[model samples]
Target chain A: MISEDYDRIDATLRSTLRDVLGLSETRAAALDADTPLFGAMPELDSMAVAGLLTEIEERLGILIEDDEIDGEMLESYGALVRFVATKTRR
Target chain B: MLRFGPDQGPLVAVALPLFEDANRVRGFAVAICRALAARGVATVLPDLPGQGESLVPLENCGILDIADGFDCATKEAWNANRRLYGVALRSGALLDKLALLDGRWHFAPQDGPSVLRDLKRIKQASQPHIRLSDADWYFDLQAPADHPDPPVEIAGNLISTALLTDLSVYAPWTPADGGPVRIVRLDSDPAPADRHVPGTALWRRAEPGNDVTLARLLADDIADWIATCER
Candidate 1:
């Protein structure tokens, strides 16, 4: 099981996705650690990536470099959550 | 569509349109002009090169050419006694990052990489992107501009390699050292401007999305903000 902190992060991530990607709350809640992004989610297009990063930066209070982003980090929900976790820890 | 009030008031030159129709909020740029006119604010809506009624060919246009249009739009405001304010929507907000710096409102400005990447994805082309300079970028191309076939269309916009090279590496947002930027982050901020009621994505392309009430509220909010800032 994930820690309570991760649960909160996941919750926050869900809300960010909803706001940036325009996903519904019900659709957002269904997403889990293994949920694939980019290809799987039609709404998370190239333009949405910019919007997503902006929202993530504001919501998590972390700064992400353009070079730091890769397909792997956005490959799955867990990958994104871990990325945020690592950034927050730093 | 350049709009001015009866009395000579502060002018808002909208630059760097987020999408095709600049200043289009629920088909309300004209409505916004009227609204701002009532509030004593003159507004100028300058069309990008190769856009709207402009006769410039789409393939001949570049980002610098677009910025030129922005410059001409704000010239009248610059000469005036009162300070000229700029309003850049979405990625167009990058205009504030450039030479055009007046009191401004940036409604969710987008970065350059995001724009380039989005351009690539819309065409479903997975070519590599290379950044040449701060405001230049390169995308891998299959052929030169004078290729056999005509210019290809991507995302409802005709584009060529020359255009792509010019639009490649624009990173507008920097660390705000108390600069002249006021971004109303619609996604993060709890302000009324960012409110997202269900089935109400006004910026959605597939659906006919128009929220008249919210548009009015947002226009009012923008007017109030500009009025306060100009004061």
Candidate 2:
């Protein structure tokens, strides 16, 4: 994917996490490559993860198979964005 | 039933999203109803069978049963000589198909299969050890063939196996199958819609929340659409 497309995916992933997790604008804006997600974020429990994935799929128009989901894909902010970017490329 | 605005004139019946989304977006839906009322349009939010305060248990109700309840609500409005319009959110879009209405407005409407997919994901998330197949996740392999399948609990909602089966093939009512229909979606969603508004998916929020701005904007959209349909 082009840099512009990657940027868009990055932004969408950020907003998806923010909206689904109910994070504030500032907190969402501050998310970076190293920002831990999933287990680190209390709001992102297993149930919330389901909603987050669905919202991401709807917004990005990408289908993420159950097998595609793993700890590494959702390890941190960058990992999640990369996983979505890879899906979009497909 | 929660009634809003004046008793006369065209009425907009509101259908909250199915299951947990209904709880998450109830306040937002109500805000939209109140906003619509402020625009001189009356609206009603009814408790569909198997939902809300309805005495019917969800496990015993089929998809049609809830749709029937919605149809009955609109029939009452039609009997009173009131022009009826439907405003549904998410899976709520599936319920208004059986209602008697001049037009239907859906916001981020989700089809039956999509709803089932979300439920399945939630179930999987809650029980990672259990392997569930898309074909017959609700059925128990050990149970006798004649034994009735038990309800599956997902995200605190006990949904019937029959309903799950129905959802796999259930699609929202389109204009080809019904009266005039309008679809609106959030800007973030890439799905085709008549119009896309700037807002996050409130129904996706983990905690129940309200979006006053989104509600007001949607109310305006609904009011304008209803006016056009009335004409």
Candidate 1 lDDT for residue B189: 41
- Per-candidate clashes, comma-separated: 3, 0
For residue B173, give model 2's deviation from the true position in Å.
Answer: 1.6
Q: Number of the top candidate by lDDT? A: 2
User: Candidate 2's error at B182, in angstroms?
Assistant: 1.0
Q: Give the CAPRI class of candidate 2.
A: high
Model 1 lDDT tens row, B1-231? 455565476677766454442423425445555666766677776766666666777666666666676777677666675467777666676544443545666665566655665555444333326332223233335556576334446656776555565556764544363435556545444333333322233343433335555445556766887767666
Model 1: pairs clashing at backbone N, Cα or C within 3 Å: B16-B92, B136-B169, B137-B168
Q: For residues B1-231, could you state the per-residue lDDT of candidate 2 as single tens digits?
A: 899999899998999878988888889989999999999999999999888998889998889999988888777688889999999999999898788789999999998888888898899999988767757887777888888988899878899988898898998879898688999999999899999999868788767888899999999999999889888
Which pairs in model 2 have colliding backbones? none
* Model 1 deviation from the true structure expressed as Cα RMSD, one decimal place: 6.2
